[model samples]
Target: MEGEAGVSVPQRSRTGLRTERLLLRQWRAEDREPFFALNADPEVMEHFPATLTREESDAFAAQSEADIDRQGWGLWAVEVAEGPDAGAFAGFVGFKVPRFDAHFMPAVEIAWRLARWSWGRGFATEAAREALDFGFTHIGFGEVVSFTAVPNVRSQAVMRRLGMTHDPDDDFDHPVLPEGHRLRRHVLYRARSAA
Candidate 1:
């Protein structure tokens, strides 16, 4: 919720720390346009079913805000602080409460998504590692999970890079997706806090 009155972007971290090149922080209203652009990219949507419509993007952005308001934890937009695209929404990395399928119990999940332009730059791994640190250290989540379609090898690679181990037996069809959805076949990975 609103921790303080009239706070523009929420006081979670006014100017968050940097991680080499990327700046991981809270989302702003102005980020909607770039976020929508990234979400609508065909190449970026290749792993998923299809590109998200503008309306869908807007609703997703609104839901992200509502998620932070309700849970105090949600995906934070990522940007390169000193790059040409500085201040632009590169993508997001954070933890979310996902509705797990029957094969695996519900759990907190660490997720990441970067623009097509941001791919192959280690942005996803770096940001996701920080989000995992935040989730396990700061948020006190016992274990953080991530999932992707069976064919989404790139994302699975990132999860592996983040030190998550696969549990193929935990794989299941995505519950929210249609029965025959192409992206419905999913795999699970989990990383537990050392402490």
Candidate 2:
């Protein structure tokens, strides 16, 4: 887990955004296994359709890195910068552009995919607030959005905690899911930049 374990030397990223408890740094080669562990955890991936194979997880991580390298910002491969989990790869929390077409076609989105051990603590919320600040302040985004199946209350709670608003009108059937799939119907939430 070379780079995946928490390293305390203040590992900075091309997309440098850090919170008091976490560092939203760029992805590293070492992140692969921990990421696979997160993806393979059924509880962590319950909101998703199924667990990803190691190859799929690696591909997903590669794509995330490419987005960061190309756009200068994407899902930040987060590390717990301090505390017991310090230097451990907690997971990712940052910005992304959903390529799928929908009513919210051109909006930037804030997202997270953290390891199960990182759940109870406020890491996701903590890191996400910084990501929101960076997106709204530095990146000049007007608004950011998040969505999950209606039953995904945990993530929705994070959205609400971020001061995002939801409207029934924004609820949508996920275009990527099959028509009757359980996770197909998603609730959308939006947050505006404080700027």
Candidate 3:
């Protein structure tokens, strides 16, 4: 709503964001444990090769913090609104430029990763929509893209819900993953800006 003059709600800055049922905000001290646990969960990391160690998790959190501080936007720490899980550390959703070359370099990728409990609640989709809104309407990005291992049906479903369309022609092997890794081959999905 900040796009229109005098209409409120500032564009999401490095601080964070809020949706109808969630908060796509910044890192908090208390979020470390659950965030680490979420990253360590085998089921949660199933699409990827392995779960991260606590040190790796901490490093990721630190990197996420720095990215937002330096770039004004990055994966945001999320919190759900009032409910049993109210004020709880849910997960993150937002934008980041991938650090590798693919057929699709120099692109903004919208992503989400929530705790197991946060699943089935639509929080990923909700927070992602807010992030995309910020990217397109507030930041004026022309298009945003997402990619995942072909087996990650759930994330693909969320991408579809956000109006992203997949084209098999854009699929490519994720450069960062080790060669021959099952998840290296990924499907790309794209969405035009809402602005």
Provide the overall lDDT of each model, using Cα atoms, as 2-decimal numbers. 0.77, 0.84, 0.84
Task: Rate residue 77 of model 3 by lDDT.
Answer: 91
**Model 2 lDDT tens row, 96-178:** 88879898877788999999988889888999998888776656677899999988999999999999999999999988899
lDDT of 1 at 118: 83
The estimated TM-scores of all candidates read 0.86, 0.91, 0.91
- Candidate 3 lDDT over 93-161, as tens digits, reads 888888898888888889888999889988888889988888877666788999999899999999999
By lDDT, rank the candidates, best first: 2, 3, 1
Alpha-carbon error at 103 in model 2, in Å? 1.3
Clashing pairs in 2: 5-87, 6-87, 6-88, 7-87
Q: Among all windows of ten consecutive residues in candidate 2, which has the lowest summed lDDT? A: 1-10
Residue 2 local lDDT, model 1: 35
Residue range 1-195, candidate 1, lDDT tens digits: 331111233334333435777887767888888888998888888778879888998887787666766555677778887768776678888777776456556677888888888889899999888767766665567788889999899999999999999977888888878998889989989899999
